[model samples]
Target: MSDYICNWDHCKFEGTKNLAIRHVIITHAPPEKVPYFCTLCSFRATNLKAFERHLTTFRQHILLEKENSQTKEYLQISTESYNVTWGNRNCDLTLKNEKYLYPEPNIVPVLLEINEDYTVYNETIIESTASQTEENNENIEKLKTKHKREMNNLAEYIIRLEKKLSARDQEIFELKRELRCNEPFIQGFNEMWEDQVRDKKEQRDRKREDWRRGKVAKENMEPLGETFSSPPSKKMKSLVKKLF
Candidate 1:
């Protein structure tokens, strides 16, 4: 990575070797044919295409640097002279001796200022108008798209909820109908249980009465048997013998 040096005056510029070479080709060379030497880098371009391509990339940098320096420093422009220095030692160019070399304009210092208020205002207004218009258009499109999607989703949700609610109502109705159908069977079971309890109680009462009567008869028979087996009393025995 060699540092970039402007070929114009051998002054070093802040760039890579490749960029420097590109700058040289684009800024100084002719379109169809290569220049014998580069105006900025002093490196020669063999073909015009390479030169044009180099200039296209380097031109922006050159213009920006010139614009920045034009305020603080003066530019040395000479139509008569091929070699001229621009803004200190950063940029220098040498042109071939041609009719365009000694053109009408000579090197002069330019004073920079922001004097035109109306032009600035007009430019600002135009830029603001364009930006606002673009933003509004974008917002409107987004809103329309978003509204359509939300409406669709809401419609689907409502339909699904309605289906769920209907199913629930149907289940409740079926449960109520089942309860009503079972009412008669439940009443019949209650009646049969009451009848069975009444019959059992009556049978138990009859058995208890028969046991009491048998106990009384057994007591009376024991006394009669004992008397028949016993001897008679003394007085009674005498009476009985006389009678016999």
Candidate 2:
């Protein structure tokens, strides 16, 4: 069989099909759509500024690789209790494909504080001052598990609230049809209301999915339960006042 030639941009990699695919995935095809995130809830949508600093560090690391910097050194400040290890060894920042950044939940990365100059890099470090403290990995895993459970509960609650809102919207449409209130103004109002609700629902759906996948941004995590609080009751009162 012929070798698989990777022609992605300036990449000159040639290998077997399996190797070529792996290279593409590890080198170029990280889910760039999903912003880089820590496995633990240590850095998430709630802490936008700090998480952004980590991203800045990621870019700096990529720049270093491009420049072919030799013997680069970085200080890793550990925010988590555990030390991150890569392939049975301490992580080398020069290696861009960090073991913890992968989504598999197999590794927990540590958080770092970046310096102000040199376009200094910040990241979640796994290898620590304790020299790869392997025992604390379980603590990271426990935190992640708890975080996932809480988020799932919140998502389910919001979904139930959305269902109630949808049902109320349907009742409004039925009332309009039953009253034969096809006045131009009424029709226009109904259309606008439908459009608004549709947009809101779509936005909520997208946010829910992103939250589930741990790819959500800051604003998307806002507490939506407040938006639905007694909305149905208030809408019912308004609907009656309008109908009469």
lDDT at 167, model 2:
100
RMSD of 1: 19.2
Worst 10 residues of 2 by lDDT: 92-101
* Local accuracy of candidate 2 as per-residue lDDT tens digits, 108-216: 4442332212221222243462233334545666887999999999999999999999999999999889768567777899999999999999999999898877855
Residue 176 displacement (Å), model 2: 2.9
**Model 1 weakest 10-residue run by lDDT:** 115-124
Give me the runs in candidate 1 sitting further than 4 Å from their true place. 1-125, 189-244
Best by lDDT: 1
**lDDT values for all models:** 0.47, 0.46
How far does residue 228 in candidate 1 sit from its true spot (Å)?
Answer: 37
Clash count, one per candidate: 6, 5
The deviation in Å at residue 117 for candidate 2 is: 34
Error of 2 at 234 (Å): 90
Q: What is the lDDT of residue 186 in candidate 2?
A: 78
